[model samples]
Target: MQARKDKQVNDMVEKEKIYPLIVDESENIAYISDPETYEVIYLNQAMRETLDLALGEDYKGRYCYDLFQNRKTPCPFCTNDRITKERFYTWKHYNEKLGKYFKLRDKLVEIDGKDYRLEICVDITDSEVHNKDLERQLSAEETVVQCIHALSGNEDMDVAIHSLLEIIGGFYRAEHAFIYECNYSENTVSNTYEWHRKDLMSRKEKLQDIPMEYVAQWKEHFEEEEAVCFPKYCEEGEARLPEILQGLGVRRHMAAPIWEETSEKYGGEKKIAGFIGVDNPTKDIEQVSLLHSVAFFVSNDIYKRRMIYKLKDLSHVDALTGLGNRNSYLEKIEDLKAAHLKSLGVVFVDINGLKYANDHFGHPYGDEMIRSVAQGIRRYFPEYSYRIGGDEFIALYIDGTKEEFEERLDGLRDYAEDECICDFSMGVNFGRGNVNIEEQIGYSDSMMYVEKQVYYGSVLDGRRLQHKALARKLVRDIEAGRFEIYLQPKINLETGAMVGAEALMRREGEDGEILLPDKFISLYETEGVIQYLDCYAFEEVCKLLQEWIKSGGTPVPVSVNFSRLSLMGSRVVNRLAEIRERYEVPPELLVIEVTESVSQMEPRALKGLMEDFEKYKFVVSLDDYGYQYSNLAILINMNFVELKLDKSLVDDLKSNPKARIVVENSIDMCRRLNQVISTAEGIENEDQLNILKEFHCDVGQGYFFSEPLPREVFLEKFGGHHVF
Candidate 1:
């Protein structure tokens, strides 16, 4: 009995010694609680300190929820049902009451014949934070790789840029992502691209062409730190938000500068061309390194796109005049053809004295002349003018009216005459409703050539000399009766009867030789003296008609040719009327001949002239009708008694079937109109005459019957007979 009592005493001593050693001295939290009552039965030193209990303060019999969790009820995470005596139950938990993470081991135990719960916890706050950081780093690396792949694989810059922005915005949880290009020379910045969250509105439209001053602070930051990052966007005690950022609702932002490296041939400097940026990012605002990496790819793409655009521009632009070059002109022609335009106006312009200027004053002066002409054309037709050659330009206007085209042409002419040191020969054609562009351009070009010929002809045998000397010579020759008249008979094709005669002009040289009109007419026209010669010829014809009437000889109608320059005078028609009325010659006995090129005159003015001639009861004939730019509109609109096929059309009648067809159609068209007389000039043989007779032509005049004869020779040859 004494031995059993001694053993019991030793067991109690061992329990008391082991409990304090294992629980009281441990650094981890340890606690024992009654399972049924949910009360804490024991607390170790770590648990007492964690609960802020003073030394020796009693924790026994306290509710575990009230002590460990400060809860009024048992902890929902008690783990009582999960604990077993077989082994410790291990779990992890975050203790809100202590603001720490823990790994806990809990077990069921029996103490003094009562069941209790025991738990031990190890704090793991530092390790948990470290692990979370590692996860974020890996995710960031993956996102960056996606961005690089997107930029490298796409050939289209816009697509690549959009993909990159989406990737960055999605990874950073940003409300907006964008790029802004800087034009240092212009002192401007523009929002070139943007991506916004689904619920947010895009700010790109409103942010264009912003002054660089708005982002001066950001650029400063870029220069110093290679980026701009702000969690709250405050700078140097300035509490007020910048208006630009505030307008964008940007509470936090980050950006990295985009840079380009110049070629070593160009000094190899790095330039800040633009920036990539994000607004109001929800995460990773401090990851400026990612933005820098993206900026490198973005800069390369931007540089490549710009280089391509510049090369394309160079290909389509004239280097000296800044006008569309030949390539652009050809491309525009195709576009115009495909457009099926409602109306079109084309103007062909040629510099008249370019070759003269280049030969006399060097190529620089000629270049200046070309540039001046291009500038004038662009001023009127800004969008569609092209410099197609060294001294030639063309302009096209879609849906433009004839009147508008003529008005613009007049304005260009006045501008050239008043402002430029060079002269221009310009031709214009306007058509409505599905007109052929190539045909219109060809017609306008033909008209331009006609005007160019007139210009060259007016320059004293195509040379620049003292104008005073030529003027005086022309006046002396006119006053000396050196200008004379000749006649070419128009014959009826079937009977070979002379129906009429065309009066031609000749100049008598100083040595008594006959000079062709071409030798002096252009000079006379240039001196503005052709009107006097025209009046002279008309008066002489009136005299011959009056003499024939007094002598009782049969007289045929006589047609007199008038220079276009002479006809342009306001008093020219009146002068001819006065001479005809003074001589008492019947108006029907005299025919007035005007060349087809008169079609180029202003429509209103040409119509007025035709009406004035009709008012005088004069027979009007269209001369040289098939020469160039054969305008059917003029023939249909004007009241002409005769249409003369030009010498060129008749010359090729035997050799070219196309020419025969054209002539046949022309004669058929004329014969259909009011029985208009179709006269074929330059008939040289029986084959030509037979062709005209087969086509039922009305009049034939050429060297076939007679060369132009002097007045005395014509009267002597067919004095009494009207038929030859």
Candidate 2:
């Protein structure tokens, strides 16, 4: 009898419903349970009253899915089954008897290691709402399919991507959405699509709806192949993104990327194809997985879509110059830096006036002249070059070493002078290594003022008739091979072996007498021929230097004075860039000098120009330091690589204690700021050199060790001397 009673208890426990709790206080209904089972699992009074079910009828021993669904067993599609190792079902079903639709959600419970499934049923009897929800799902699927087809068909990629995002937003009932893609070639991710609700779009045409952090999250997704959810608009609660979103009234968003597979065969080819996202203004929560799937879908299709966008991208590229269009350069720079990398140089080049040539010869001749300069540079710096503004060009070089690069400017300068096409001025600068690209650009422009100051100073004399005539004669002679390149020995004060030499420009008159820039520079400047003269001198110097490098000459950094007149226009930068490319010259070997006083343009305008100069990898020096104490604020703000003391300071430092103190103070400040301090015009004796050395100057240049010589003469005399 005891064994029989135990069996009865086990059977009761095995029943689906065993416990019932219903009080007769509020409603006229009954809670039913199976006598065999002990679980209080029936919703009788509350559920029967709500759903109009019959009370007192027992639903004991019946499973949740079996009650709501027609199936006797668990449904195939169920999440409860995943959590618990039990047969389970979802709300999807067709009831042949009642022909009613009902949706159910379920949870699993464990008691003494035994699993039981609990569930709730919602009467989804309204056919309209059910059909509408189905329609929404179908619409989203169709839109995804359409985007895939468009992508596969190789249509206009940007437009297709934008439209695809729109369809996704509509399907998901989102207020806004966007797509971003990673470029395998550039290793960059850029915005591909963005859309806002029609209500918002009608109000604000330019929607600043997307936050940088959102874009940043997508980048992380691309890198890590993970999904991101923005629970709040801003994680730091800094109100930055929250403000923007609140303006749009958007509160929540979900983003994901289409990740590329890594393969040894395509070592450098791994990149995100694209990403898709959705945003909702009023919704407190978003369906994260769905958004991620949409993003992944978009990214997966990017490979074929890029082929179509390629043509559009090419259309924006200048065929003659191979540089980005004016419209594209600004956007490209922003995107490039947003990817968290620094541009080594931002070189801005302005071609000397073609208007004069057009008026004198014809438009065709002027165009050819422009083409010549463009072709030269395009062929030289194939990696990066852009014709951004009218008669203005920009180029970015990744491997720029300033001091080394300036030395190679001779070839372009010579080419321009020899052709006698047009004159040019250039300004170049260095980046703060880790600073924002905009700041880097600003600094470069400020350095350019130094070049511009000299340019303006040169053009002053050319405005007069007499000065013009003399300048034209001198320029013609220089272009006609009447100039010689002088090389000055740069002794390694430590060893005296031929280290390197400075390439100085001088005009060889009809009598074979050499005249330096100071003698005829005024003439060139006044005659509007300084650009040609500068180019002639520069190119001649380059040819000789190239030869020296080939003829077993010691490799030492060479300093070249790029006359302010020579760098008056943008063409100088491109021309120099071409020269470096043509000769395969390393940038570290070149040093360019500019007077700080020359770059007096508005800070905003000059900043980008100077930064562009440094992007080309040439060390920029203030040729005459201390003369422009007025502009020192801007100079310090722009950040020069070297502070070259003028001969005025060098000549007076030893004789005048005050002058020495100034020089010493300047050196100290430069040292603290990580700027190089060098002495120029150190001449006559070792005493001056010793004084410079004592002041802890990094380098010295002038006529004491040896005057500028011909390239061959320089190599013969100073080649071994420059070696430490």
Candidate 3:
């Protein structure tokens, strides 16, 4: 048909009348062009109208494609040899500039023996809008499927969801887009993910914790199987935007509801789960409706993840103490191993005396004790703690030091002490680099056991067991009358007369041989059984005093040794009172000797016990003064009745100038405080005794007087009148 039309155009041009034939002012647009140059030679009045040309515009030399198709050259289909390829060039295509489509029919022609092309074009865009809409719907569907993959492929859900929100927001030219996870049971919606277009104000943080009641109208609209589009706020009162939307400057919004049958955790019913919402978006009802596909796939991803986490909580969290369970610790160890470790610290904590508490106080109180310890640990290390055993907890610090962990450990101990929960022993070990994580953890565990032995040590584990056995044996011996007190004479430095005797403990062994401080004292102290031994020794001293009084002789002052364990217990005063009442011994007749370590005890508690001894009229002597850990400052304030110089001071007193000066200065300091100084230990020669006498030491007791003897022999040798 276009060939015959071009033949007619050629015949008309043969007559030199083609311009008159195509010049009608009608909707059928026609233009004549020089085929080789694609230059427009003539344009009909309808073509001029279609191009929106000016009344005086000329088009004789302009490129036709540039004018109509917005191309720099001729249209590819409008070729010089087009009639040779086909009878006519007929096609329909859209024009972006005009926001419409055009259909064109073209054919080659010869006018006035010159080759030209005749083109007729018509608008066809409005008739094909539905087909374009279908293509856009398919594109959006593919995008939603790709987003699901992106969300699932990433390990971090927050990052994946945020990326998806941005993609969706960008597709619709939206200012803001976000996901709100509506927790129906909790009656709240949490803003869980968001995207803010570049240069736009973010309302992600602001639009949070919204209750459904606040968006009641929005929820009502989302029940439809399409995006709830609010193109204009409050266009109808029944579909009014919430106040929050107004505050967010959201003039238009489109949201797709995520609905699902609820899990049993949320009461198991069909409901709107959450929604993906966009604010002030580009206006297109079809494009916005397509967002429902994204909401559907993303909501399922969220639900599946929540269920996985819920199951993980059941397996990974400790039931009794609510701490991370042992399996969690193993997982943490893997994390630690995988880390590029720099100054990673591991703290091993064990609840000391937990077995004792459980056995003696019942498991209920023991459970409470464990909970108190857990609470204390959570104060500083809330996230990394693990209950790896019944009474053991492990805490990790990825970038912490041994010193910082130790300080926190001390605070935990203090808390246990104050709460009376149970004592805890902790060890800290820190290292950097890709070192063995398990090795560091084991090292920390070993250190913790060592610490545990120092405070409320358990008898069932470690080196303390031997000491515990030794203490038990000594206790059995004391019960069987196998322990005896030996008195080492103390003499007046000035008067050259015996003034007192320091009661030394002696135990009869299975070999019927004598046991001195060397045989038992160290173990007793380490095992913390010294408190019992001290009480027994004091009772024996009382018996000796009563015997001396009944024999009708003047009894000298006898000082008995007391350990750190003796001063700390609440039962100390009562035990002393009971023994005092039993022995009928006045307080002045018996002196109490406190060891060097008393300074390390809780100062207020030790002071309180010391006051009680003072009230009872007992001579309170600070034993082993100037020894390791002993504080000379105690003498300056408390006015002790005597200061027994530690064996260290006397070990080299005769030869060492420093030792001599220490003893001398200590004696002088004691005199200033109105207290007496008694020197003991390693005093085996007259030179040592003479050194003490010259220092103005008020008293002395040691092997120089005589080695300690059994109770019977001591009574025979020293209890008699004028025995000195």
Candidate 4:
């Protein structure tokens, strides 16, 4: 009786079951198994329908693999790495017989004392909807790659279009694809390429005349920014069908514009690149989506291809020689100015005798002469050349330096003299420290003119001749203890004690006299002899400061005026770097003054050059502030740490209310610009100094502090004292 009761209870449990066993509730087959022994213990009703096996009869005692195939061992893909410790694992399997994707899932489980896995699988025949989308995307990618390769293949637009159509036809399994090239010269759209599939030439040829009605719609669509898609079904009934569709058996198609980017204003008319029509209807919706994708891709690819071709065309000729230009020489200079490249040398070269050759031998021979000169120029500076002017050329040598540049110039000059009856002049400029390319080129051009005058035996008659003589005489006079480094004391406005001194350039010719830079500066400006004089004076002042420092003298900083021309050129930075290292002096102790004119030209390039000066922590002061077009925004943007007010502002402020207001506003603006405003040219008296002090001028350098004195006199009188 007890045994009968236990059987009845077991029967009740079996009837209820542990999990659901309904047919409609299950979309996929489900089964449970012992992981180690690989025994199938349970099967849902869906499993029976999937394997065509009876749930309780056929697969009850079988291993999981036995249901799929009679494998000698477990499937390689079925492993703990994938299934163990995971709630579920899913994968797809393509069935040859069914021709469908079967999405399978394996659930991790542990039953009784052994680990087990649950297998669930769905037929996934409907999943092809998603697969079709993916396949369409794949086709799109393939078409894009093909179009890229075709466009990149050649410069000929017709051939590129032909290749593109061929690729489209083959990729989409279409019977034919053709491109109608719009010839703007003739104002007609002609067939450039007509690709036909095998065994379909007659039908494809029958559709040669694609009819105006179909093309008219395309014209209207492009006019209204509507893309032309053919076949009523693919167009979703939005577009009219092409008449060619009826004769050629073309079930679907896509057409896009092949336009030159600058077509409208350039008198280029609308071009109808021929339609890409697929002969057969789409097997699935995959082909339905191909139209728009291919249209956009073709348009974009054609544009990119055309641009590449145009670029190749532009980059072909030599800019300097007006011959075949080198790649990137012209490119690099513009790039450097645009801040794309650094340390570019702008080399200015002038043909020495091209003018003479043109005049004496007539222009034909002169042209030949110029060509010969160009050949020689090419041999030395082979990479970059530009015909900037008739007899002038420019070259941009990357990573070029003053020395390398000089060597190249000298070599080119020698080569020109040796090979022909002419000479060439060259100059190089860059951004080094406070020096910039504009000033470098300016100086270089001046030097070139000077050298040219010398070459032509006209230096004595040129403007530079007198200036050159004056510079030489001044240099000699200075060396002979005639030139003096006048110390204009820079005083702290509040303390009235000298903190620094500006080394003003003064000279006495043969007789006893005090001459300012103005008297000889214009002279030295000719050959850039001012730069030389500055170097000489800078060295002398530095030596004096060194001795003062060594003798435990007061720490006094010395400021020197730099030529606006020199400071804006590359040499200033390079030379300053060299001098600072050699002298082993703190950059703070040596202040280099800059004028406002440097800001007018080459602001962008100069800003980039400032990094070199700022690197050594050098003090850069705007010597003549409130001069020129001084924009507070622009001034504050520079790397200058000090703003030196012009002496004109300080000297006239007491009597001039307008000047006083300007000074006060300038001071306010400088405070916001984070600049220490120093005053120069302030030589009136105590009243001007008091006004400067009230304005909170940080430092003052002028006659009020102390009159300009020689470096030795300055050291002897105020070296030990706190001369402020």
Which has the greatest lDDT?
A: 1
TM-score of each: 0.48, 0.35, 0.40, 0.36
Per-residue CA lDDT of model 4 for 1-724, tens digit only, reads: 9989966654553355425433443666777766776777667776666667653465545776666545667767675467864566778776543456778777676443446677676777787758777877787777767776887685787787677767777776777776554544444445546766667663433434444554676677655543455654544677756675555556666555544445666567645553344445343324534555555556666667757876776676644355444344445445555564445556677776555445543565456546666776677677666665677766656665667766877777676545543456666565544435456567767777776766668533333332333354455456677667778777777777777778887877434567787766775665466777777777877776777777886667888787766665665677776766676676768887778766665766677557767875777777877665665655756767677877767778889999888887777766776555545466568888778778887777666567787767777788766644
Cα displacement (Å) at residue 332, model 2: 72
| Local distance difference test, each candidate | 0.82, 0.59, 0.75, 0.64
lDDT of 3 by residue, 51-141 (tens): 8999989776799888878898566755556543236588776766567777867777666667678777787777678777777778787
Residue 190 lDDT (model 3): 78
Ranking by lDDT: 1, 3, 4, 2
Backbone clashes in candidate 1 total 0
Off by over 4 Å in 2: 1-475, 491-500, 510-512, 627-630, 722-724
Candidate 3 has a TM-score of 0.40
lDDT of 3 at 318: 84
The residue pairs found clashing in candidate 1 are none
Residue runs of model 1 more than 4 Å from their true location after superposition: 1-25, 29-131, 232-242, 263-267, 319-323, 334-341, 349-385, 399-426, 446-724
**Where does candidate 2 have its weakest 10-residue lDDT segment?**
29-38
Angstrom error at residue 136, model 1: 3.0
Candidate order (TM-score):
1, 3, 4, 2
Q: How far is candidate 3 from the true structure (C-alpha RMSD, Å)?
A: 28.0
lDDT of 1 by residue, 646-677 (tens): 98999888899999999999999887899889
Local error of candidate 4 at 701, Å? 2.7
lDDT of prediction 4? 0.64
- Backbone clash count, each prediction separately: 0, 68, 0, 20
